[model samples]
Target: MNNNIKRTLTTTILAAAFTVQAGENNFDQAYNSVSEADLRSHVKTLASDEFEGRQPTTIGEEKTLDYLTRQFTALGYQPGNNGSFLQPVELVRIEADPNVTLQIGDDSFEYKQNMVIGTSREQESVSLKDSELVFVGYGVNAPEYGWNDYAGVDVKGKTAVILVNDPGFANPDSGKFQGKTMTYYGRWTYKYEEASRQGAAGALIIHETAPASYGWSVVANSWSGPQYHLVTANGNKDRVAVEGWLSVEAAQTVFQKAGLDFEKLKEQAKNGPTAKAMSVKASVTVKSSLKRSKSNNFIATLPGSKAPDEHIIYTGHWDHLGKDPSKKGDNIYNGAHDNATGTASLISMAKAFASLKQRPARSVSFLIVTAEEQGLLGSKYYAEHPVYPLNKTVANLNLDAMNILGRTKDVAVVGFGKSELETYLTKAAKRQGRIITQEDRPEAGYYYRSDHFSFAKKGVPALYAEGGAESADEESAKYRKKMKVILNGCYHQVCDEYRDSWDFGGIIEDTQMFFEVGYDLANSDDWPKWNKTSEFQRPE
Candidate 1:
């Protein structure tokens, strides 16, 4: 090779790299088009008191669905569900009468005071009278981990008293049940499902503030309302007659009455592989009225220019705790940060994609689902009856309550290391001069608490990215402290309303990074795959 020829080739390669970098700046223009003013406007409107907290099966649903449909149409995207933007989801709203009670041996626990109970069964009335109670350490039966909390005890027709989170959470050993990082077994949803599969008549989870990741008020506020669940063809026949949570005080009382040391039992449960289930002297009566209603899951799509059959989903739940008129001053649980931010981002991102000079090769869909505050019902229905086949759906990027704390030096990938989508996320984050990491509070099982889990359960790879702890400014220490305060204090509370204190700089940056990740994936032919050992990789 001649020196002149080699120099010419090197110069050409450098020139192209510069050109690509310059082209990236053009893409940034599209990304930066997601203005903070737009995000704030959308959030303020959706989270306003007028929406009645955005609850499904109420006036809130009408306002929310209408707003999303209008925004999607304005963005020039087509309806995702066939030719209609609305995907009708039939749901049963069940509210347990305040007359519920639980009796553990000689101790009596009153409803909403010591404990709360509800049923998944679609019935006008449901009850579990004189149902025996059994202490199931964690109520998990994982064959992969070779651990079974319900091994020796049979809970059929009995009430299974379970612990929140999992044994690995309390124990420090990484090799034991994935250590502190909560898995499917640690999720409350998984606990109830296991109880039902075991033919248990009822399931009650003991709530400790730290392990449960929220206070008793949160538990009460979240579970006490009209719980919404998709109306299954089987009528939730396999479900337990009752499922609820017992306050720590209530649990202590039950343990004392049963002649068991509460702290000692907790220690045994934490020391996994040795904990055992035993029968307790207790019973429960659960009664609830079930009313059927329908909610619309707003879905819109930017069809692929090339591979129209393939899909990339973007999900954000639009539901929040409705107006609590019982409160004295502020009654509405305006979930501004809880989800209005994410929902607004959905509109902003959709608009950005529509502004692209050319559509990506793979289709991208925006799903603003309902009843997430109640449960992931809207997404669950979509997963069961998808507009696009699960096998063909490439990946899901879920936005839920994005940080309004300003841009940070890192992005938190909730349930990180579970899929190849993180590879894309890491690259996109790096391009924005940020790092990628995992959720700081993995034990909370935040991964299973959102809409993305619906898609992941159906074997599609999902990504949930959020702002990380490393604040980009000098207020780093203050930012981290404030982060804890918000999650502990305002999260899921009436205080979660939109505040002028929020610095939308970070939200906009994270939004752009999310858009880029989806943009890259939609343009590529590659199908993201779950990591080999991912618990959700198994196809349904």
Candidate 2:
């Protein structure tokens, strides 16, 4: 069937389903089953120092799996993965040697200072020796947009130094590549992937704070530790030999050494210019220590009374940055706001679903995944090796970083207008006297950063929404300011630990809304769909 016909049929079915109303008292009981006290208890336990930051392949993962299993079993949910609650995800951990230097001509840059380098290839040593450096505009080869940075350049054995973000970011007024709202092409992951496809030996992204959305410290801390990737037969040998980032200061030095004007070249890139040879050779060696391990994605299901095959999936990642023992004083990266809150919200929602006297027509499942901090590994694995067929899966509702900063008058729908799932979110929010709003910082690409992206990439209609900036009561400006301070200071740091001062009212409200959204999806016979203009679409 054509896409338009399928969409029309689905819309008609959905409209008819909405005409009949389920008992309000039954839904009220389930919605009220989600409690702030339950959310707080789970967050306190998961984000505790005793969990060792919930790192995969550690004792932390074991504790987490055990806790989730016990909770689901108590809530009367059956194991979702066949008869087992756990789905094993094979992963390889590669920790690159930090005592290395990147040499660009006569100038050298220190690792974790001006440069952060690593390799996904499971090898003892990988090197790029005397490799010529080519400046590939945005390092984007997007044919759909009539832009190709590597149009004339053959970087087979050379290193490509690319700019961060896309050309649209540099010239937002040009109406190119979504114009400041970053597409998937703007991501550092995309740059590296494109470079590898062009057969580059190495790729380095020139980072700017405004474009990358985080400071150099984040790059240093995040890339310095052991990196994890899903195990492949070839051990990710298809990827570039070396992948890394260059601080703006280091990039400037390299540009000066090459006798090229960096600022002028950036302007030309915005107009779709081809790659430029920097006339500078680069050398770097990455010595890695590899470990192969297995992690589990916890899945529990409440089978429907009618259409048990069709499913509604709720996902929340349970992994964090783990602990850094090298740091002085407190070193644990207890990711309370980063994910522990999301993880807790999942357990709370599961309880609410289980409390429903008459189950929804479609099955509802809770998927608490591992290694999300390591680039959404668990969710990616599940999306690829799904226990329930992707075609049968109705929708994915992801909860990541729940709101703990009091009640809000609005909900922020990240990557809004992508899917029909937002219609359900809008209806649920209206019940709470709240409105749906777009995320404050769309350029940051919060949508692509979460577990839902894994499912969305495979054509699943996914929704990721949370509390917005507007306060429910009087302190609107003050609330916004305070939230900014708290989120900014604590993101990916040791300061992300749970606090007694947190207000769980917002978390409770958001969780309740999530419960309603999922319940609606579970009961409805119609499938949600991606918008026509969205890059993602259900496959024919």
**TM-score, predicted candidate 2 vs. hidden true structure:** 0.96
What does candidate 2's lDDT look like per residue over 1-540, in tens digits? 975465456545543554354463377877888887898899999999999899899888999899999999999999999899999999999999889999999999999889999998989899999999999989998889999999988999999999998888878889899887888888888898999999999999998999888889888888888889999999899999999999999999999999999998988998885589999999988999999999999999999989999999999999988878778999888899989999999999999888878888899999989888888899999999999999999999999999877899999999977988877887778779898889988888788889999999999999999999888887645665676787785778888988887888889999999998888888878798899889999889
| Regions of candidate 1 where Cα sits further than 4 Å from its true position | 1-26, 273-280, 475-488, 538-540
Residue-pair clashes per candidate: 2, 0
Alpha carbon lDDT at 195, candidate 2: 93
Top-scoring candidate (TM-score): 2
The numbered model that scores best in lDDT is 2
> What TM-score goes with each of the models?
0.93, 0.96
List, residue by residue over 146-170, the lDDT tens digit for candidate 1.
Answer: 8988777778888888899888889
lDDT of each candidate versus the true structure: 0.83, 0.89
